[model samples]
Target chain A: MGQTTAEKIFAAHLRDEPFPGTKVIDIDRVLCHEITTPVAIADLEARGKDRVFDNTKIKAVIDHVTPAKDSKTALQAKMLRDWAHRHDIKDFFDVGRNGVCHAIFPEKGYIRPGFTVIMGDSHTCTHGAFGAFAAGIGTTDLEVGMLKGVCAFREPKTIRINLNGKLPAGVYAKDAILFVIGQIGVNGATDRVIEFHGSVVEAMSMESRMTLCNMAIEAGGTSGICQPDAVTVDYLWPFISGEFASKKAALTEYGKWCADADAAYEKVLDFDMSQIGPQVTYGYKPDCVKPVAEMVGTPVDQVYIGSCTNGRLEDLRIAAKILKGKKIVDSVRGIVSPATPQVFQDALKEGIIDIFMQAGFCVTNPTCGACLGMSNGVLSDGEVCASTTNRNFAGRMGKGGMVHLMSPATAAATALAGSIALAKP
Target chain B: MKKIFGGPVLCLDRSDINTDEIIPAKYLTEVTKEALKPYILEDLSLDGFDAKGAPLKNAQVIVTRGNFGCGSSREHAPWVFEVNNIHTIIAESYARIFRQNMFNCGMLAIELPKAQIDTLVDMAKGGALVVSVDLPAQRISATADGREESFSFELSPFDKALVEAGGWVEFADARY
Candidate 1:
């Protein structure tokens, strides 16, 4: 049988066959954040197994509730800080240096093709855009990955999603993914790896690929992956240059991670990108999606553009382009948060921040606060928000607030309209 | 880890019960699992379901529809159920990570087919339902309104090992 991309990665990392269908694979990288790592840390401490397997392989960040919204949150951050310091883990990122874990780790070239990555956060699948096998794990698996550098998984089954045709001008990767999730429903890809292929995926930049893979969990996918190609080599060039003889060499090595032509897939799904338009999620589920035209004029109390999913420079540039000379409506509050300090600085240099501020948006530091209802721009009771974040689970942003997930362009247009609106082509 | 265990069944007849509804993000900062008890399902909103009322008051086992505990990879979702002494969740399906988290905690996340789940839901609605799960037999028996019914489910060998060892921490301790 021809091995799928995920199967090949897993075979390379295989350490044990724990059971008939489960493989214990060695992890290349373990990502951690304040919210989930503390529990694993506490458990490790109680077991007297507090040492990390490999310090250099672990990347820790505190982006969830940056600046410590409360004493409890402060304590959580402090625990992670002390633990990171105790282990002398040099890759730790604190408040100013921190960005969303999914965003910053890849920006640093921490992930590579065919590598296996695990994190306590579900969006760890975002790293799979590099052709790596990355999956979100829980505290127990996180503990094992941190202490032993190995995690168990059921044998992977790949679902090939072919994105053919061209995306419309105003549509973006976020729209493409949302449309996929809509077609597949929320649990459509459960227990399977989604291997994205076809021309549409080939044309996407690394940032857009990350955005698409970031929401794999929303559709219950173990990971969403793209084949490694020139774009992958280009993104890692600066950090990987010295390790490789040339960009061509890097591409040749990484290209080995692509799936075999005859690779067996559980099923194959084809989506025509030209048929998709600006998409928005109504109701609470991520799959409750509709074209922007169907949801037009739905009033929104806030507009947020930031998260591991859509807070990249491309997201900001597109949103800024829509808000350049226009101001958001007075009643609709708008917030823009760049995903990383690097993204923030780059946006600043590109005058994206000024454009957002001039358009009546609150520019905040890089924290994953408002995305999960932690802080920065949480909505009030009965309020509705047009957001670019991944999930739209009920009360996700606030206890009684509603979130309508959309692309950055759509969110910016909604900010100006004070209601759900499609971005103009 | 008892081989046979179950209790009063809590029926939540809905699909896609996400982690946010299982345990909201606001309580995620709290360090201890016990701190998450009061907030369990605090944000869940269904037509006839009450977050603070009787349905969840004594739920030791939960019977729900498909994709239960979807969204977010927070282990806190299962931890809340652990703190509340509610360990078993019967659903048509579960989000991948949440299901793993449940098994890692030495709890049961039983997945039955849609027809089986519909039968169980129907049984629970008839009257108060108490379920007994037998791990060795791989069977669950439901008793309600002087009637008894049974269903069978399968657990992977790895998950069975996780339960037998009393969670991943214990399993890792022995091996690592």
Candidate 2:
């Protein structure tokens, strides 16, 4: 029986056959963020299992409500900081040094092909872009991963999503993924790994691939993965140069993680990317998508472009290209937070920050605060935001606020128009 | 752990009842489960649904439509329900992580067919529906306005074991 990439990775990491069709797999990396880890740390402390299995294997960050939105949030960060220090986990990232967990982890080369990674945040699936089997787990599973270095799962199954044809002008990985989610509905890929394949995926940059994989959870997928090819090698080349003999050698080694030509899949979906347009989500669901042209002139009070999904340097450059030499409408408030300090620094060197500021967008520090309605740029009640972040769930950005998920280009265009608008090709 | 449990049913009557609706993200900073109690479904906007009012305050079980508890991998969603003593959730389907989170917390997240969910929703609309879950038998029965109906469901052996041991932590403590 041929095995998919996810199956291959699972088999390689298998530590126990706990039950029929269930495997206890050794995890290579355990990602932790303040919002969820504090509870796990507290539980571990209560159980007298306060030690981490491997401190180096764990990466901790305080990004969610950075700068301590309140005393409670501050305490959450404090608990995680004290725990990380006590455990001697040196990869701990604090305020100013931290970015969104998904972005910063990969940026720092913590993920690699064929690794099994688990985190308590849903967007942890973002790391699957590196050909790893990464999934978002709950606190109990996270604690187990931290303590025993293992997590249990059902035998792996896969849904192959083949994005074929060339993307049309102004269309991007965000649109292709949004279109896929709209077809699958929210629970379309439940309990299954989505292996993104085909020429479209082959051409996407790492940033775009991360954006695609990050929303796998939105479609109820365990993870979204891409084959580790030359693109993957190039993305990690700088950090991994000393580890591999050469880029070609690294590519050949990572190539082992790719699915077999005849890999079996539970379901296969084919999408024609050329048919997609710049996409925007309406209503309160990420899957409630429509071509931005269909939503032209729909009023928006705010525009936000940042998150693990679309806050990378490429996303910033794309939005900056649209906003250059232009000013956002007075009725709209625009904000952009680069995904990491590196991305922010790179954008600053490229004058992307100047473009955003001149265009009236507030450039905030790297933090995931506003996306979940914690702080930074939270929307007021009844406000509508055209955002480049994933998830349009009701009140996701604030109480009674509406979030319309779009690509950074669409978000920049909407900011200029003070309404939902498509970016000019 | 008890194999059979039942209580007054509170039907959300909507698909895609996400975690953000169950427990908004702003409250995630609170480390204790009890701190999440008052805000359960605070941001949810369904017709005639008051998150803090009698309908939710008095209910001990939740019946909703497809894709219940979608969005975000926040265990706070399940913790909020656990704090409120609403231990069972019946739906047509669930978001993957949220479903697992429920099981991890030693709570019941039952998945019925769409047809069975329709019957439950209709029964719930009849003003007072009481649901009884028999875990050993894998059966769920609903009674409303003198009418009694039952449906059969299945849980994987692993999930069954986890629930039997009262969550993953307990299950792991014995083995790991």
Candidate 3:
């Protein structure tokens, strides 16, 4: 049988002695933000290893706790900053320069097709949308990857997710992926690589594709990826400069990285997007999604439209279109954040920020804030937030807050109605 | 690290217990392990416990349902258990990163089917019972009245070796 995308990648980087099992493979790129980097720096110190495997391949960002917010967070960010400087890492992005690590990594061409990327944050799988074998490991393994350049891996079987048929009006990538997860429970793809394919997937934009891959971990997916195409090249073309020039020029050489036509997949799931609706999570989990049409009057206290999962320019544009020339309900507070600094600038130039501001939505710096309940748009007791971000686990946003996950359009419409409502089609 | 006479296995009885709940992102600001133990379940509501309410005080092992440790790849989740001196965890299944994090901390995370998990969980609910785990033998036994009811399990030899030699640091120290 022909090799799957995961099989092909692992085969190329497989180590000796372990052969097909427990292969020790080289990690091409690594990324970390303040919340994850400080502990990793401490790990390296404890290992008595002062050197990183390759400083150029490692990039650190100040995203999770931007502007510090508190003295402790400030100390942590400063520690990571000092460590990066002492190690002479060239790609360190301080606050205002860096944005959410997942969104900015691909924008900078730090993550490329056919290369494996690892990060301390769980959404590292977001880069897999570019046809790479990317995944999230914990801080210890992340530190180990920095010190040794290689990390252990077990070959994962591939689960092919076929996104067949065109999406119906008001339905989107967020709805489609949420539908797929609801079909198979959270642990449906445990330790398995999810390869999204089919005509529907082929036609999706890079930002939409990222939304699909970003939540793969929510389904217990080892990683999620989409096959690369001309769209991928166009998106990354501008970022090719400096040390990455020669490395990126060889992108065409990695053309053989996609799954073979004859490959034997472990399992294949066919999702017809035509039947899916504008979905939203009513409970405390991503997989608890139901059609927004059926959930019209579920009251909400806030609306959030940003995160690695749904904070791209297209997402912002969708929200802007729905929210323009309108004000949010008097009691509700809404916040919009761009996924990265460049996305923020692009939105500003395009007047998307004005649309949000005019709609009574607060625009904040590009950070993963409020998405993980750290800051910016955190919830108070008895509050319900209709959010575009991933995961709505209990106590996720606040000590006693509830979250409803939805698309930006849905989130905006909900804000306007002062309750969970469907977006204008 | 051979045979653990561990567990008055406290039952969480829940699934999708993400790392954020175990150790919230607010506490992740600290670089070192210091000040982490007190915030393991910082804002949880538990029964039969004091105001601090970290009920794992008397537990060396915890039992939970499937998809335990489901969200963000925070290594602090396992560190919370380790600092509480939790030696083992029994679950129906576990998220990959969380399971690996447990192994890296030299903490045993054993997965079994629902029926088996129910058996173990029920045994613990009988008050102050133990899961006598024999690591090399790949079997765990819960004894009563001088008779042993044993359950078999499968652990890859590679993982067994790592556990026997303690976890990541020891293995790395030997290699480097």
Q: Clash number for every model?
A: 0, 0, 0
Clashing pairs in 1: none
Please give the range of 10 consecutive residues that has the lowest summed lDDT in model 3 chain B: B45-54
Residue-level lDDT tens digits of model 1 in A303-336: 9999999999999999999999999999999999
lDDT of 2: 0.91
Q: What is the interface RMSD of candidate 1, in Å?
A: 0.8
Cα error, candidate 3, residue B62 (Å): 1.1
> Lowest summed lDDT over 10 consecutive residues: which window, candidate 2 chain B?
B1-10
Candidate 2, residues A1-425, lDDT tens digits: the string is 77899999988998888679878899999999999999999999988889899999999999998889789999999999999999999999998899999999999999999999999999988999999999999888998889888888888789999999999878888988998999998888888899999999999999999999999988999999999999999999989999999999999999999999889899999988877888889989888988889999999999999999999999999999999999999999999999899999999999999999999999899999889999989999999999889989989999889999999999999999999998998
Per-residue lDDT over B47-159 for candidate 2, one digit per residue giving the tens place of the 0 to 100 score: 99987689788888998898888889899998898888788989888888888888888888998898988888888777699998888899988999988999999898888
Ranking the candidates on DockQ from highest down gives 1, 2, 3
Q: What is the C-alpha lDDT of each candidate?
A: 0.93, 0.91, 0.81
TM-score of 3: 0.95
True interface contacts retained by model 2 = 0.85
Highest lDDT among the candidates is held by which one? 1
How would you encode candidate 3's per-residue C-alpha lDDT over B1-176 as one tens digit per residue? Answer: 33243555577776777787788877787776756887876644344434254446777777788888888899888887777777688888899999887776667888778897777667656655566777767778774334456787777655665566677656655654
User: What's the best-to-worst order under TM-score?
Assistant: 1, 2, 3
